[model samples]
Target chain A: MARPVHSFVCEIGRVCSKAELKASEQPSALWVGVKAQKLPDLCLACLQAGGVFDSAFTYPSSISSHWAAVYVFCVPKLSKPVVLFSHAKQFHSVSAQIPAAVWDERKMREISGADFIGLNDLRPIIIHPESAKFVTNPLRGAHAPGRRPSARERSAGHEEPAGHGSEYGFAGTGEEGEFQIPVGPVHAGIIEPGHFRFHVGGEPIHKLEVRLSFLHRGIEDFACGRPMDGVLPLIEQVSADESVANGVAYAQAVESLASIEVPRKAESLRLILLELERIYSHLADLGGMAMDVGYYASSSRFATLRENMMRLNGRVGGSRFLRGLVVVGGMARDMPEDSLRQIRTSLRLFSDSLAKTEDLTLSSSTFIDRAFSTGRVSPEVARRLSLVGPVARASGVPCDARKHFAYGAYRSNAVRESLGQGGDVFSRFMVKLGEVKESVRLIEHQLAQDIDGPVLSERRDLSKLPSGRMALGWTEAPRGSCMFLVRSANKGALGRLAIRTASWRNWIGIQEAVRGNITADFPLINKSFNLSYAGADL
Target chain B: MHEFDALLSPKTDRIYADSPDPAIRELALFLKSRPLSPFSRSIAVRMVDCGSSNDVELEEGLTNAPQVDCERFGIHFVASPRHADVLIASGPVSVNMKLALEKTYRAMSRPKAVVAAGDGACTGGLLAGAHGVYKSGRVEEVIPVDVKVAGNPPAPYELVLGMLKAGQILSKKRI
Candidate 1:
């Protein structure tokens, strides 16, 4: 382990014991293994000493009867990241210290059926209580053939005895002059569904509660027992807009476990695809903010630019959403010189149009007034919630995975972390705009480098991969940092897979950001964060 | 300003189309030759995402982008199901969202058509038999679907064409 990680473990060891803490090192990060009961104390001590909680996940352990809980934390000024893990039948929760851990622990409990004691919010994060009875925990031994119930049976189980609104209950503020407003599991727009409950006094929101997991498709369970190669397609679909990032993250996990080095050419190509994905994803959020603020012209212009980029994605990778392009070892297919030329040409056009759209949007007083000073998340609150991506960056936290934990081509290429001061809607908007421009520069830089060597690694047989190995993979998704934990079973099948997307961590920040803002400003604020329901739910 | 001017007259050559498919070509020729039928010319669509990764929704949004411009052909996405002539549902219908899908379909007036807009909705695609997903993950299992647009997520023009086909079905049902 690195000195910083060793010292941090020593610090945690003082609270627990040196014998209780086990340290191991991975290529990208550090791993410190601890006993389950000591997790709460260790996490609290780490957070108190300025350690940022990156992600926490749980998986069934092959060696033990108990499940293993992994919590990744990054201590500032430390060059290497640290992942502290512990094994237990049930783990103590750290949600009281880090609010983001609430959702992580809830999801851990739901999937593994592991108890999380002292969890402030015990409400089901992914599975509805009504459907929970019928649907078997896919991670458990109940995953037998022919176990899937018929649609008729499933719907019958979900039928409420008339007058019962929903299975999950929303917490109310219980204060005078506060009325609850419930938004959709089915919204008005062409977006995925998740319910949002707001306790409001007139137009100002007092407390907001978000109920997601409406789009949960059991992705983690579906990936289990499948061969390493077959899981890429499933990972790509984890969040459509972030297909490349998720795919890269999953691939990196597999590569790290297998100790396969991605060729330099493939690394550069992967970086290009990742930056392109960032460009299109950021464009959507930028345009959505405009649409929420009624700046239709700028929004349309952004939409046009996004479409052109998606088209370019299709032309280069054979899918508009860049699906089927990233495989386990390296890339699924190589980018031809013709495609590179085309992408470069399109990028020039895209940059000019983006500048114009940014000018048009910023020039509008109505858009400016609505966006500025709205949905402000203070730096303290952002750090407490452990928010990532543009949302955290906008709040003045320099938490870019590319810059901090440089992996793949990022290890060589320079990455500039875009920062924002206000953490308001306008700040988020500017951050995204700045990121899009930065992504364009990154793509150009990658393209300027020599594109040579084999795109796909030589190791083609995934079934022959060694088993009983565990590794962590992470990439800077357009939304934020997307991390994947992979454990290979004895038969080269996925023993356990846990994914913690950026949206899953950042969704809690929205609950705090929306407070004290008017109900009408909710849409603008929500669009600024643009958290993913499917990603979070999965 | 120059970019805005160029966007006003975006070239149609880049728009996605199945020109190689004789049936679609014949249908296009037929629609072009005839006086535009009310259903064929103008239609409002309401999209519901039951349990998708949201790729379908992205493509659906892009259908209205200046390049595709399905609105020029009188296709618009309305907020309410009551105002829609076609309901385009995406994703494999999850158990949590199955009732919502049924309600949205029921809310549309009679003589309406439904388009299953992605492989997930049409046949459950990758998440066909997962534990969290509804059985088979097909939209038709929960509601009547008039058109099945198949892709991991179908391209923007493909989604538009699928809705147009559903509009054709709505016109036929009226007759």
Candidate 2:
């Protein structure tokens, strides 16, 4: 374990002053402290070491008054992720070089009021610029750092997002017949609220600007000062469809923070729950892709399969969305013998039905024609944005967190990182189809194992964990890989909780995918990626 | 050939049982027996997600799924509020989305009803008074709600039941 950390440190030594690099180790990751001036150089060095830019966020320092930024990178050959920390009040921006870091930096700017010196796009990512009336940047710890708000104090002096205006200056083409079309904050579908501005001349789109954050509810800020046990509900709300995945990720972070090992039975049950979520979530995307193309028959069949899947989930976990089952240390409660038996039978039926539906859908020539080349997110752009999950896989990027950053049951299961080369809607469809089969096979495999034991591990007093101890939890959610950065504060509370959902990374893919596609195919392309507005906003 | 075979096989029942859920069955039977009104027979709904984490929206979509199929009960979700008879808003209404919620409510013509679906909308759920949200985060705080269907997100059948009640209220308002 120390070998990889030493190698990473050795790599960092070549680029910057070794004296300024202070390295420390944790059970799961290596933490290094760097001067703010050295952030860009360290980030570049990490990237050169074959590290993928995982996530970056700003948190208030515990001992000092200064705000610090942590940039995390997942490097190959390292047993754990590498985290570099620096005080970020007026730090140099890495977004100028690493385009993937743009949104993270923009969010850091708004939340912590951190000034990134050389950053170009300084637009408000969460709080709308026109409605920036706040006593403080509501999320910043400067006002009442580490102090929990009482019931009555929750609303007073809090910033209310006010304006509903399309005021962001979208770069437009000055070509003849070019016109801009803005859609939503409230859209035409039953989907979540987001705005998409298109620069279209007639048939093809010149540029597409996606403005989200309409559903930003300050989930991360609200998690601060709350007890570790109390924060799971909020994490579950980050994206409802990915509840089990987010819960498991957060639980793993907390479990790792306290060094609690989960029992095997609990781990197997969690695997079942996570894969069930993937199957249902991917089903929605498949159905929506077909529905958008006017193929109602295939779409309805997919929806039926999804409904049956959800009903099975309801039977197993008592909630259609599979909530309240994955608690911090282990399973919230043991799955009954009957439920497991039911699950096995249901999965068999599900796979058989799924095979029929996949066969039926793929056999349709009209469906193929519509989905074939409609929304193409090239492999180059996918890499540039650091996209994850099926969207990345469809574009030939193969960045599944389950396979790359293996956690829980995935570590032993040896996931096949399903790949597609087309980088188009059909490729994404095929990728999701492949993943659904994989998830079913995985669940079946897990169920066949000896998984009978205590569901929950013995509860520990989490407040005993050292202050400022932080851990990273990553999960391959249905949409993609979502991450949780948990930093322990005094008295078991989280000082700062940063969430980066797959939708956050993949939302940019939609903007690129929509380019050159006709206005009518926009919905099809958007459905192909199926990025969650609330997940991205949160 | 595979498509035809799959289509021919009865995946879902041709007709649902009369009362799988007693509550939903009661509501469906009541709606069936109720006199014909503009909304009693059919209600056009526009769902606005104020800030509930997309769960309520998924349930709303599932209401259209073959198992729950709210379409059989004449519950049609529309694209525009102007064409809607009931405005279903899910919340803890975010501060950013409050104005849009208000605008959507105002767009619907009179003789309209509002259904606050999900615990978030009805009582602000977990994120009640958190930052980036208005006071209490309830739909009624911003707009009047005739029916409040509460759950973390009420299941599809529950939402359909709530809409059925909303249709009845819309009928009364029309009179």
Candidate 3:
């Protein structure tokens, strides 16, 4: 079924004159290659033509003369996504049209040494300012031709020379009574590090700036030159909580590039695991929201439910976090009938307890008072930022990939998208609660289907697999849309891998959401949109 | 109400008993014999994630779950390193965070002990030698680690056991 948006993209290509449209093997996505000079105009036309910016990334092409700047857009009524590419010798920028493109463009500039011409915020992203002198982009010399500049030459161009006191110059509101509060990079809780700067006048926050990438582990660089199978573990490590989603997205991308058809049973099992992940992840957020509100009773109850789910995951999948379960072609292991039975029984128990906890949490006046209207993000801000997953759903934007893209088992069984209109902490909390219930129903429905078949597809030798094929794989992770673009090179090694996690997209929304809220309410607001630093940084 | 009651009285004893596999049992016994055991049993731990997938952090959070309540064993998570007796570090030591890790470790008192949680912190796990990762990605390279809990993300029981073992090290050092 060709989506109407595909026709619109084709129309844009014809009008632009310098663009060539190519059909992607992956359903619901068309690739348009445009000339570098026409890219800005074409992208502006795309936005005018009703395309919402999804993500933008740059990767060195195997041809070596130029790097490819890929911009993904979600066109309304298009079943397939549209990706516009423009080749550049050195630099190009698109943040002038779409503000969300700034972060991705900055990252591309730093990692690939491409000059983004019109990017206003050019501060160093992935590489820390202090370490910029010592650490060069790992991918700098890998594919680029000619003698690469020495580390000194590369470091000289980047902003903020080493040891110039503060790593980032805090841009303040400059009000007379404005004071700054810096939190994290090393927080008091058991969480990953990312620094947050809040400019506050009394208790009200005037502006908030976030500095991340402390967990940049060179994952994309590490994937290069490694055998395809060897990289699944690394992809799964992108974010511990979203391992199943990331693994599935990476696997699907690889599978699509290789034209591998996974057995029906494997798809069903994947759906089950993905839903289980959603349940546990959302439960953690629910519990955290309660804890932040000082509702210990409901928080502990939610924690108990989450722990039960984790234990069930251990019994069913052999890992509490469901690691090493998903592979490129299919699942690494199959679920036995007895394990399925146990999961069903445990899920029923969990559902009943979760209902009680949800009731208790929503009924509490104090919990409601704290979470009701705090950290409100209007529908406009959410749409402008292109927020995804529960955060967007909470703001009443229907952006669920499962419903829109319908990959894997979702194609057979439709997913019910849970939405809330409040656009506040309470709305996000309700949306998560609603999503948890939906996931429980999805798991139950999936388990009832006939799921007897080979779990793992026949393994193809990595060296023999075709090379230089690019494919996009995406999944609706609990937080939002987790997408992966994989380019395979000779010998089954990855040429380029670009990831857009839900946290990466929704983090900017938090900066806008916390405005005007009191400093004391910051933790509550932050928890409502609980994003991952490692996932975003990577 | 009965279900709530049952949840409150979890099967923690059974889980705890099954947890002290030969390696942890030895550590438990060693902890009991330390001269400063009384003061050491109740220890405050500060966690610093150098560069983990946050899986280790999830496991660490579960230690506070009612099922694996480490507080009953006199172990608690403190906000500041200065007040902490044990430092629990998870994930591979990323190059950017190496200095912060060192500063955090130095901020702790002299009798402090470090427990490297997760395979990442213990031996750099899957991320070892990655370009952005520090040397070996292990906590021991930057600071002395008394106990290493090994798992992609060590289970909550394992984390509890590792922290206890670190508490024992603190006790031994104090003597």
Best by DockQ: 3
Residues A172-228 of candidate 3 have per-residue lDDT tens digits of 889899999999888888888989999999999999999898898878777877887
lDDT of 2 by residue, A388-449 (tens): 88998999997888887788888899998899999999999999999999998999999888
Q: Highest lDDT, which number?
A: 2
- Better-scoring candidate (TM-score), 1 or 3: 3
Looking at model 2 chain A, report the run of 10 residues with the lowest lDDT sum: A157-166
| 10 residues in a row with least lDDT, candidate 1 chain B | B8-17
TM-score of decoy 1: 0.93
Candidate 1's DockQ: 0.57
- Residue pairs with colliding backbones in model 2 are B92-B120
**When only chain A is evaluated, what TM-score does every model earn?**
0.93, 0.94, 0.94
If you assessed candidate 3 against the hidden native complex, which CAPRI class would it receive?
medium
- Per-prediction DockQ comes to 0.57, 0.51, 0.58
Tens-digit per-residue lDDT, B1-175, candidate 1: 3332465345443322357534346446645654546687789899999998999998888877776778876788998899988999998887778777888888888789999988899889998878778888899889988899898888876777788778878877863
Candidate 2 CAPRI classification by DockQ: medium
lDDT tens digits by residue: candidate 3, B36-105: 5655659999999999998889888988888767787778898888998889998688878887888898
Better of 2 and 3 by DockQ: 3
For residues A211-268, could you state the per-residue lDDT of candidate 1 as single tens digits? 8888888888788889887888899878999999999999999988887878888899
